[model samples]
Target: MTSHHPAPRPARPVADLFSADGRLKAIPRKPARREALLAHLAATLFEDGRDYREPEVNEALLAVHEDFPALRRYLVIGGFLGRTKDGSTYRRQQQPGSPGGAIFAVA
Candidate 1:
């Protein structure tokens, strides 16, 4: 009698991605993959020369953004917005006190 066993299936490579720090890239918002993240953040957080608090900002971006300290730090270092000492608000650069800053708004 012939055997009834079936052939084994071929293995597929894992599409798993990772960051430089070896963190999982399953979040789907890597800088290399998504450069517009900060632009979106800037638009959502800034209003009338005012910035947003971490909680508020996180609420806005957390749902759609990946947790990247580099990106967050970039935003601050670039002077797109200034973080408050209390960590509760943001001040739009290039606003009233800013000599040369552009306004960001969601449209």
Candidate 2:
């Protein structure tokens, strides 16, 4: 008798969204992939736990795309970056499933 298991989903590489110069090709449509892509972009462009001024954040994000405001909002909304109430500063937040947290194992 043969035992069968469903195939596992292939790992999606978010890097494909970037051009050769490292600019984002476009914002993803699917929420999950979009969050993942945003997280990756935040990690690449911003330093973890570092405080960045409003203009500094824009400068970094602008390197990826012309729509800096949307990208900044996505990064903040995705829980990748924490913004001050006055929006003067931004800092990278620890990702839920990242190195410091439990990834796939059961609780």
Candidate 3:
């Protein structure tokens, strides 16, 4: 008997991906909204597995956050980024030149 693999499913449309209520049903987590936001920010801040400084990241999240403290805390606590001992801004936790390279999973 010949073996057969099913064809891959087509990607869903943007509108279809988000339900009528504008909720992401696929993301079944209590903090899905926060996760999504952090993911977006991480993507914007990083380039080729490396991290960026606070100003760059903050500019991206400026409109979304009214208070800088809260935004920074949220990202740090989520393990998306880390801060230095001194009074510096946020940086992505994963080091760029690491053996396994960079990685940011759902938190």
Candidate 4:
């Protein structure tokens, strides 16, 4: 018997998650969808090889949501963002070009 996995489709645009003025309507409730949304934020907001101070991180995140701390925590827990043990600096994690050229389906 053979087990076959379906090919991964491209990630959908998460624009709907945000309002016209570009603030999030709400953080997504489901984990997978949330991660995808965070990935979009991580990619767009942070630059590579640059470290952001906590204030800078907060300011950027606040532009997206008033609950910046929760968004920060979620981004860290989801591996979309990283920080030092002292929590003084934050940076976006480098994501690989879709491993196996696919994202595993999550429900």
Query: Positional deviation of 4 in candidate 3, in angstroms?
Result: 21
- Candidate 2, residues 1-107: lDDT per residue as tens digits? 22353433345988888899988889877766777787787778888878999999999989888999988887776678889999999999888444533232212
Instruction: Give the better candidate number (2 or 4) by TM-score.
Output: 4
Of 1 and 2, the candidate ranking higher by TM-score: 2
lDDT of each: 0.48, 0.78, 0.52, 0.80
Between prediction 2 and prediction 3, the one with superior TM-score is: 2
- Report the candidate with higher TM-score, 1 versus 4: 4
Estimate, for each residue in 1-107, the C-alpha lDDT of model 1 and write its tens digit: 33563433232222234445544355334332222334444555566465566766555444444664544555565455688887677665542224433233213
Model 2 C-alpha lDDT versus the unseen true structure: 0.78
User: What TM-score do all the candidates reach, one by one?
Assistant: 0.43, 0.77, 0.46, 0.79
Candidate 4's displacement at residue 13, Å, is 1.9
Task: Decide which is better by lDDT, 2 or 4.
Answer: 4
Which lDDT tens digits does candidate 4 get at residues 10-59? 46779999999999999988766777788888898899789999999899
Candidate 2 stretches greater than 4 Å from native: 1-10, 97-107
Error of 3 at 76 (Å): 1.0
Clash number for every model?
1, 0, 0, 0
Question: How far does residue 59 in candidate 2 sit from its true spot (Å)?
Answer: 0.6
